[model samples]
Target: MMKATPESMTDADGLEMDRCFSTRGGVAYVGLRDRWPWYTKRRSASWPFAELRVADDKIVISSMFGKYAVTRDDVASISRFGRIPALYDGFKFVIRGDYEAVVFWALWGPPVRAAFVRHGWEIVG
Candidate 1:
C-alpha cells in the first residue's frame, strides 16, 4: 500500500477521472464562490475556501489550497461531526483510505445527503 505522510500527501485529484469514471450529469455542489465558505478554520477542508461537488457516483471538493474526491467504493461510513457545532455541524463520509470529508447539512445539505442515499451508502449517525 502507498503510505502518505502529511507533508507529502496531497488531496485527491479528479482532473483525470473523466477517463476512468463517467463524469457526466447528476452534478450538485455548494459553497461560496467568493472565497469564504460561510465559516473559516477547518482541517479537512481546503485552506482559504472550498467547494463541494457531487456528480454521477462521485464527490469532488476543491479550493485555492487543494482538491479531494472519492467514488462510492471508497466510502465506508457517514456520521455527525460536531467539532465546531451548528455552522460546522455536518455529516462526514469516512473513506476506505483513511480519508474523510465534512459536508454541512445546512449548505444544500438535503441534496448532499440525498446523493449518498441514492447510492444506498451509509449514515452511521
Candidate 2:
C-alpha cells in the first residue's frame, strides 16, 4: 500500500491540505464532500485522515485518526448530497441515502439540534 505524505494530501477543492500541527490536545473534525462520509477529523500527526481501499467485496473506508474502518456492509446508507442553507442560518440538513443508516454532524448544540429536528431529521443521542 502507498502511504500518504504531507505533500500528497489534497482537499476536495484539489488544493493541497493545510499541514498544521496540532498544538493542543484534541481532534480537528471535518466532513468530506463527494464521498460516503458524514463526519471526519484529524488529530495528532500519526492519526489517519481518510483512505479508501477495497476489502472483501465492498469498498472500505480506512480512517486514519483511529482504528476506525467502515465497509459497505457496515454502512446503512450513503449520502450523495447535503445542504445547510445559508438563509436558514443555524439550521442544517444532512441527507443520507441508506435505509436505517444515520447521519451525524459534529456540532452538538441545542440550537443546531432543534434546527435539525425542525427539518424532520431525527437527532440521535
Candidate 3:
C-alpha cells in the first residue's frame, strides 16, 4: 500500500492527498466517505480529503475510494440544520441531496438504509 508522501502527494484520482496544516479555500465535500467504502483500503482515496475547490458554487463530492464524482446540484434536500449523525466514528459527514442521496440509498447497506428510511429523507429517483 502506498502511503502519503511528498513524491506521492497526488492520488490516482487526481486529488491532493496531503493533510496539510492549512489551505486557502478548503471546505468539506460531504458524503464522500460514505460513498466509497473501499477508500481506506486503497491509496487513491487519500487525496479528496486535502483541499477541494468548490467550483461554480457547487461541491463535487468524489466517492471516498476516488472512483467517481458525485454531482452537487442534484441535491434535493439538506439536513434541517446541515447535520447528520456520525457514521465513521464521528469523522464522517452525511449530506443528503437528490441525485447523490439516491445513489447513496442504492449503495448503502442494511443499517444505513434503515437509518435513512427513519430520517424520511429519501428522494424519488
Q: Best candidate, lDDT-wise?
A: 1
Candidate-wise lDDT, in order? 0.46, 0.33, 0.31
lDDT-based ranking, best first? Answer: 1, 2, 3
Candidate 2: where are CA atoms >4 Å away? 1-49, 82-125
Residue range 1-125, candidate 2, lDDT tens digits: 99989678854433344431111111232444555664454232212343322222232222334423234345443332233343212212222442222222222234544433443434344
lDDT of 2: 0.33
Best by TM-score: 1
lDDT of 3 by residue, 32-80 (tens): 3445561232132232243322222232334443322323444434332
| Residue 54 C-alpha lDDT in model 1 | 56
| lDDT of prediction 3 | 0.31
In candidate 2 the C-alpha lDDT for residue 106 amounts to 23
Q: TM-scores of the models, in the given order?
A: 0.46, 0.24, 0.23
Q: Which stretches of candidate 1 lie over 4 Å from their true place?
A: 1-48, 83-88, 99-108
Overall local distance difference test of candidate 1: 0.46
lDDT of 1 by residue, 1-125 (tens): 99755455333553333222121111112221235553333444322255555555666655544555667787765665443443333655556755234443333344545655665556565
Sequence-dependent TM-score of model 3: 0.23
